[model samples]
Target: MASPQKTSRKAAGTRAAIRRARPASGRAHSGDAGDDIGLDALVGHAGYAVRRFQLWIFQDFIKTLATVDIRPTQYAVKNVIGANPGLSQMAVAKRLGIERARLVHLLDSLEERDFVSRIPSTIDRRSHALHLTTRGKAALAQFKRLAAEHERHVAEKIGKANREQLLRILACFT
Candidate 1:
């Protein structure tokens, strides 16, 4: 059995250790040694910043698309196909920055879902033209509405002014 005074001292020491471990400013400071877990150059890196923003937006995207059951990439593909009926598969792939091989597989999935159809091009026998089905049009409409809401939410989060500036900066790279 320990004395009350020794127990009090031990409790006091534990509190002091916790206070030392956590800095007053909230973020933990690396003591004399260098093991600070802080955003050093990651905050300054453009790719890292974009990836962070993408992750943030994608979380919201997942929630918004849950009812619709379509991913952002799928929505984009449907949008392009809906807008540009008779567009070549290669053209869609190029515009989306996707490879032809990958786009073919993606198209296969959409076709299986009956969202899109690939017709042999009259002008180019080697190419297949893309078209969106009635179902795809409905999904694209829902996606556009959800996407607009997402855009507004993101703008509110980052501030409209900052969002515009950030968009301009991002556009320069693209």
Candidate 2:
């Protein structure tokens, strides 16, 4: 076995190397030895910054709605269904960019929760039209209130103006 003193020295050296590798903000910098290893390099990269921001926003949304047990995608699907009743499953899937098979499973879960209903479509007997249940309408209202609170948290973090600007810029991509 290695001596405790030797282990301590090894650990200390490892910690020091980590400190050197990380920025003052304590986030790990990703780059090769010759590259600038800090936020300066990361902030200049749009995709990386957007991904990091997306993760932060998603985590905040999940935490804020933990009590209601709604994820971001679920909330989005619910909102669309609530707003447009009798939309076909395919319509919802295409609108939200969810895969058809995946949407079927998602709809199944929502139906099991008594939050959504799938009725036989009059125009296309093979397809199911989506609708929110009475319970779902009530739950959606609660979800909206919670989502607004989450938005407020986001606004506080990035400022309302920046949030609005971010939305506008992101809208271009979608």
Candidate 3:
């Protein structure tokens, strides 16, 4: 095996090479270093663009609903449950791409807040049916209103026509 001092020196040399490669503009790069690593290659990739857009949407959504004290996933889960009352937990997990255990934790928090209830399933005794309580319905209504405002912000950022086109394009993936 290489000596510890040799490994340390090699690592330091690698870091120095990275520093030398960085742009001289002094602006922070995307991943690391205090320089821009021109994103020409990433700019053309659809997945990269989509990920960047998703990040922006999430940040804006979180900021918009900061007062509501809800996260993007929580909002999505509650919305799905609100719309599909009496849905099975596993069904919800599948629909929302959330793991069963993670969904249970989210449901626990919502139940504690009186925003959701897990009732005994009529069809499957092993599974629980999810539903929103009266308070949850009211809260969901408010959430929808704020979410609309967030959508409006999105529309403003990207014009209505572009947003519609983007949605049409993204629908293929969903």
Candidate 4:
């Protein structure tokens, strides 16, 4: 019979071998699976399949947003103003998570297009209140419709349930 010490060593070696033989569920190892690394390095080291899939999804969103002639940031600003009529410039900036100075430039562009107006605030004489013009409201409506269509398309690509779950996960991140 084998010595007890040798038998224990043999059992440990067999377990290690079994673990090594199993395929990993996460990122496949090209080499050095035990290497300690940061998230960026790990994502970078991952196979191209996952990265390509992510890029394709982003590309679709970019194309959809482009169709309305509004970038994602512009859409966000318009949505904030639409939702909060008579909101102060500072308030809108805060709600949209943009700097006051940057919001000014965005408001300027919208104002030039007659999509929005900044009037003296009734409550605060020192501040200007934001409002969407009829034109602005119409534009927002159009953009919203387009967004709905885009969302449907994406949902079709990835099931509606999955899209809802994705939104929930993203909300947690924000």
Top model by TM-score, which number? 3
lDDT of 2 by residue, 49-136 (tens): 7898889999999999999999998998999999999999999999999998998888888999999999999999898889999999
Q: Sort by TM-score, best first: what order? A: 3, 2, 1, 4
lDDT of 3 by residue, 90-170 (tens): 999999899999999999999999999999998889989999999999999999999999999999999999999999998
lDDT of 2: 0.88
Model 4, 78-128: lDDT tens per residue? 888888888898988887788999989988988998889999988889999
lDDT, candidate 1, at 80:
89
State TM-scores per candidate: 0.74, 0.77, 0.78, 0.64
Candidate 1 lDDT for residue 98: 85
- Regions of model 3 farther than 4 Å from truth: 1-35
Q: Judging by lDDT, tell me the better candidate of 2 and 4.
A: 2
Between candidates 2 and 4, the TM-score winner: 2
Model 1 regions more than 4 Å off: 1-36
Indicate the residue-level lDDT of 120 in model 4: 96
Clash pairs for candidate 2: none
TM-score of 2: 0.77
Q: Give the clash count for each candidate.
A: 0, 0, 0, 0
